[model samples]
Target: MGFLNAVGNVGLALSVAQVATASFYIYLEWYAHGKWTGHPGMQEMKKIAENISSSSFSTASTSSDELEFLRSHPSPEGVASSIDKEFRRMEKFVAFAGRGLTSSWSGRRIVVTPSWILFSHRTTFLPICQLLGHLGAVVVGTRCINNQIASLGEDEEQERADPMLGSGVVMATIRIADMDSGACMLSFDLPASELENFRLYLCCPLVYAQGVSLEPSIIQRFLEAFSAVVQENEPIEIPPSMELERCIGCLSNQTSVAIRRSCAGECGSCRCRPMWCEMCVGRWFASRLAQSHVPTSEWVASRVPCPTCRSLFCVRDVISLKRAQY
Candidate 1:
């Protein structure tokens, strides 16, 4: 039954892909033929273009009359508006494709695109996948978790047996799978709160697969494991002892004495030496959050890992360091 369902989903996806590809090519050809050149909005655009061309040929600044004309014309703004409208249309087509593909599958749905399509149009495809990913959808060619089953505990079993018990009760089976690898990563029956973090982690690419949940402590462990893996695969380079005294993030000699005291023993008792200033670390944290595809608002509460040691630290920790006195 599962094999049949999978085959059906593949056929549906192929059909949707064909429709989308045809629509995109048709629109491109139409656009190339200047079908929209005679649009009613073009009259104002033509006037603006004439004014701009004339301005380019003249050395003297335009008079107040010309400035007013330019302001009223807003040719550049009009062009941008048209481009935005077309982009929205394309976005709608992609959304429609995603929805149609998802509805054809049972259980958790995953949308798989040909590797050629992904490589050729990654910029367009990534955003669409990201949108679907946020809504509990999975995209192919990335790590994901899928169909996990967990056994119910005795108390939970009794709750399920009770006819009076309502839908408020959490289920025993918690399934999570990696869509890219097409393998189930977690299947244990954990609390829903704990499970929520795993879901969030899967949707974002900042963290790698570690066969664990997303609690701060658990994430720290994952980072440590990741660091070990990275270290094993790469050659190690020992920094000079003098360089170690400066901030690793900014290479600044100015260190915050107060932060060192406050965060004492927080970074683990590694005698390897602490080499980051408060301000530098703060900036580094901000940069990581900015680089992440996950929405900033969503990650504001998340902890950041150290660039040097992969030790997980919170924004508050970095902020405190930033405000620390000598």
Candidate 2:
């Protein structure tokens, strides 16, 4: 074969390989988390919350834990208590970090607290966020494509089921959501030049929250692929801005009437704003509550300085982030 032809074949092969690898990652992620068919685990969790017949609580406070109220609660109340307790525990350390992190059960949108985003910038963590954001965008985008293809008026068997065809886009979407949601965890210390210190936390959608860990290979490959895409295609950036119309510190921590009543801002209660990523924050709360440390109002009040400009903005201002679209 001619040299130029050989080079063309190699480029095509690499492109095909990239797509295939991306697809495999998505399928495995969906399969592991049981998200392919509308999140069976989350559905079960919801069912457990609704099940009045069960005497045994799906999530209950242990006797050793100091929070005895949760121990005394019934199954439904106990589960809600569990979510609140654990969420507080995991986020307690993070409460003082920055503003804009939100957790709202009423609206079903856990926004990345502005504090966390600003902290990333303060600590020079934008690259990490960007990488994760790109990953989320690709993954979600791929899912969108697959869903589109499946809906194209063809029989399920006849239409292509192969995720490889649109996997790159899927992975990209997932990364974007990860960054946007603020569930993308980064190493505490990374060199100024290298953003290799990031790993998707359990809060990430594709990874199982119950079984999450730092595995560098896949994340690295995804980053490299995404970078190449940007270098080659030069796509336009979609400026995103969050509108936080209310005080971040004023939000009710739990959706429960009892918890909200007890902890509402009017009651001299400090509210824990929602984390940018609700699912991630929910899982974080669940994990922490299992250990038993209710988040406090004071801890949530302390705010971190912005990483970029080092400006101190109120939680409300942080929530309402406005950026130029161009």
Candidate 3:
């Protein structure tokens, strides 16, 4: 009986050790992947880790046989498979829940909505630690990469004098949002001045690119602690579209003022209008149409009949309706 009891104690210790080993490997996998792939893969791994945590607890609690099996069979491949499956499930959840959360958070939560798309040029680390120090965004994540901004030259300064060019400053794309809600604000031609804090103060190359949406609570907290290195609010100068001749709406003498949804579809352009304007909707349609079997000629015609909808409309009309509120 004494020997049998000793064997049971050893089995329990082995089970505990197996759990610890699995956790360590999982952590290593996530740490390695996060640096390579950025936040999306990290988030996916977090979801996987949560699943493993639950499974470990449940197996230890209810089923000793299952726990023993995992310990004896000990397959790293099995652990990896489990992680991948959980990520697939998260992708499905995002597909349905992403849009609504993005919109709601942007409208209600963002305190100071930036008009620039922010990108970090550093390719080494997830901006989480820095962002958490600067702003605690829960849903949105930022990555840092190394990129050099060019110094302004005489020729570039000359172009700035032209009304078409507006300012000598080069525009940047930036994304800012509440982390939890997934609501994001994208500014394509944001002023270089707004990023002064990150560029000069943070001593990191920042630019614009795609990023994960974070929850608002996380962002709010992050900003609260973020050091305000630059206090000067330079009024940004935005240039008019010079592509007027090639644009159907501009050629047709429609409203030259183009209102678009930067992140929250809350503005009149996104909410009141039945469809998105040619500016907002056409770009996406053009890419999708290019890949599809649709004829190029059909896209340029002013009042071509849409084979898909059987509706008669001009080039401008179709583009507008294509982006209309659905």
RMSD to true structure for each model, in Å = 19.8, 23.4, 22.0
**Decoy 1 TM-score against native:** 0.21
| TM-score pick, better of 1 and 2 | 1
lDDT of 2 by residue, 1-326 (tens): 69999999999999999999987885675455653422333333344444323444334321223224433443434544454454454233231111111111112212132111212322121212111122231222212224233332221222332332332122111233334355643212111111121112321223322232333433244334433322333222324553332222212232211011121232322233322322222222222322343443322232333322333322222221124475
1-326: candidate 3 lDDT, tens digit per residue = 99999999999999999999987776676556545223443453344334434543344322223233334434433333433443344111110112211111222211121111122222211111111111222212332212332322321311122232233433333444433454542322223322322221121124334464323332232233221211111221233432322222112233222222332222222222222223322332332333343565554322323323334333223211112232
Deviation from truth (RMSD, Å), model 2: 23.4
The lDDT of each candidate is 0.35, 0.30, 0.30
Off by over 4 Å in 3: 1-171, 179-279, 282-326
**Backbone clashes, each candidate:** 10, 50, 46
| Candidate order, lDDT descending | 1, 3, 2
**Model 3 lDDT, full chain set:** 0.30
Residue 41 Cα positional deviation in candidate 3, in Å, after optimal superposition: 2.0
